[model samples]
Target: MANASSAATLSICSSSSSSFFSHIPTRVPSQFSFNHQKPKCRLLTIRAAVYTAPSPTPMPAASSSGIVLVDKSDSDKVNRLKSVYLEKIVPILKEEFGYNNIHEVPGIEKIVVNCGMGDAEQNSKGLEATIKDLSLITGQRPVKTRAKKSIASFKLREGTTVGIAVTLRGNVMYSFLDRLINLGFPRTRDFQGVNPNSFDGHGNYSIGMRDQSVFPEIRYEALGKTRGMDVCITTSANTDNEAQRLLALLGMPFKEGAGPTVLLRRKRKKAHHFDSKIKGKK
Candidate 1:
């Protein structure tokens, strides 16, 4: 009986141990479990792209004398009036004036083109048109001329734009002069010659054009209104005689019998007539 009882106790203990082992979960190995296993990484090979720049075209080499021999097609041609002045006018003036040196011969210093707009403050479009026309006439850009002081009579305020002007020098001056002489004057109506009395006492000449349409650059149909312009030619000449002579040689057409001597005589006669009237009144 004792042997049988001990055997029964051993069987019960074995059954309980087997049931506890079944309730506890078994763990998978770290190498084979998806949750703990690391994935194999593969190395990728990439190739870099190479770029090459094209070579530049060779430029014409300069000569030993420091002169670059450029093709005529590639270079800007010289101005015709400038060439004439250098080759022809200079030598003629030197002989005619009996100048001691070539530098002593009077030449044009600059040209000032002015267009006054009394109603610029009121007519903004006119002012803009004037600026555009002036710019077209002169190759250079036009600058606004502002009123220096307020004028009650004219209703002009200080710093208000009253006019536009352009000062041309160098090659541009020569080109403008050439065009004015060759094209502008010839296009004017009933034009015999320019006024001989328009020279200032200080070797400068002024020309007033009644119509801006005289210039070929201006389109008559496009104009909002007709405008006038004043052209003042400044020269290096010491006296009016020298300046007038210079201009005459350069194809400036002066009125017949309107020389400096004739103008001087007319001035003297006017002065004498005024003196006679004063004496008679006394």
Candidate 2:
């Protein structure tokens, strides 16, 4: 009777254990896994901490491209040359020179400013000062001109930088010419106007300045030594006469009755006077 009671108690304990184990979950959900088979590539979904509206800001308009419309503006000012050309020059060209087409009217193409750096080869300060003054005057940096061939007599070596030059075009060229004509020429010592015969017969005029100090760009005290420069103005005209007329109309301040024509007339008058005196003596 004792053995049977013991056996029955053991069976009851085993059944209770089996029931408890069955109630427990044996498999984990896919969300939480420790198995490392072929790894899954799942994108994580995250929500923002704060709520905000989706608004796109507008951008500024892009600049118009092309050669002609680059600097076009409502506030664009007509400079002295352009003003005179439109108001006075065009009509004069049409009436006096028989220029029927607007394109035939002479206009300035460019202005070239050059300075010799012969002294700069010896002193670095000279080049610096020249560059500074030139940049101030032209509102542009200069390109150094180098010697192509060595010259033993002048002690110049090949590839040696001997000069600096700046080419002015568009508005800068016009402004420079305006200043040169209105202010620079008047400030020159003795104040003789530019030579009319300096035109290269192809609508280009070259003028030489003996002293750069004449320009307001160069301060007298700051200069170590005086320097000279050359100014070359190129025009779209076909001939020297047309370019000369264009320049004069644009206020170049050419000397009155001091040109080659005037000189020739004077020479003819002298010759005639001499001939009359000889006839009287006879």
Candidate 3:
């Protein structure tokens, strides 16, 4: 019985090995040569499987040095402002504010456009439409903002997309600002200048728009939803006065005499000793 089992195992092993070898493709000779001199000669020589790789195709040539490459230039607003600064603003600032160096003049750093989609939590499609509208207005894709913490009152959940924002800087920021000042603001309903008191003490100015339709990109009939947006312009100035001056020079229209100092003085004052003197005389 033991001899019979051993013979069966050997036969099974041989059959399995033969089956495995059968799956492998037969190798063909890699090299072949023919005698061109003797056209009638028949050749069946199987040379060693040496691989002779095909030559690689050559790469395309680069543009010539003489051809001028178009690169990003300073935005129209930036260029115009620079020229204005050199020709007018610098001298005016020097005469008025006693700023000795051109570097002392405040400059805009960045502008942030934020739009909150209140209906997004109820309908996700609203958020998408808001994103498209914002992208069209700013000429940049917005980053969707999500809720940081769950709120039971607002039905807001953590990680829920609630708003979209675009932060503009450098040339893009300047260009957007130019459009906002020249185009967008003019299209606004009331047509009043922006309030001068919107600047934070740290030289950052914030503007609130009632309707997104003021921007030319949004058509009144095509709007999926009416949304308000906040535009914050951050400046390199240390004080609100400096920032106000910088924005004003860049053609940001502010209400007449609504300067920072004037707004501070307009606050309600406490009853003075003049009232006590009048009471005493009475």
Steric collisions counted per model: 0, 0, 0
Collision count of model 3 = 0
Q: Candidate 1 — which residues are off by over 4 angstroms?
A: 1-78, 261-282
- lDDT string, candidate 2, 1-282, tens digits: 999999999999999999999998999888898877997799999987996888873321222310011123312565756655665566766676897788888888899999987866778877987888999888899989999999999998999889999999988898888778767888889987778788776888999998877778778888767878999999998888778777776767676775423223333366888889999999
Query: What is each predicted model's overall lDDT from 0 to 1?
Result: 0.82, 0.77, 0.77
What's the lDDT for candidate 1? 0.82
- The residue pairs that clash in candidate 3, if any, are none
User: In model 3, how large is the Cα lDDT of residue 84?
Assistant: 50
Winner on TM-score between 2 and 3 is 2
* Residue-wise C-alpha lDDT for candidate 1, range 154-263, written one tens digit per residue: 78789998899999999999888878987899999999999877887778999998888888898888987888899999999998888887787677878877865434
Model 2 CA lDDT for position 272: 80
Give lDDT: candidate 3, residue 4: 100
Best by lDDT: 1
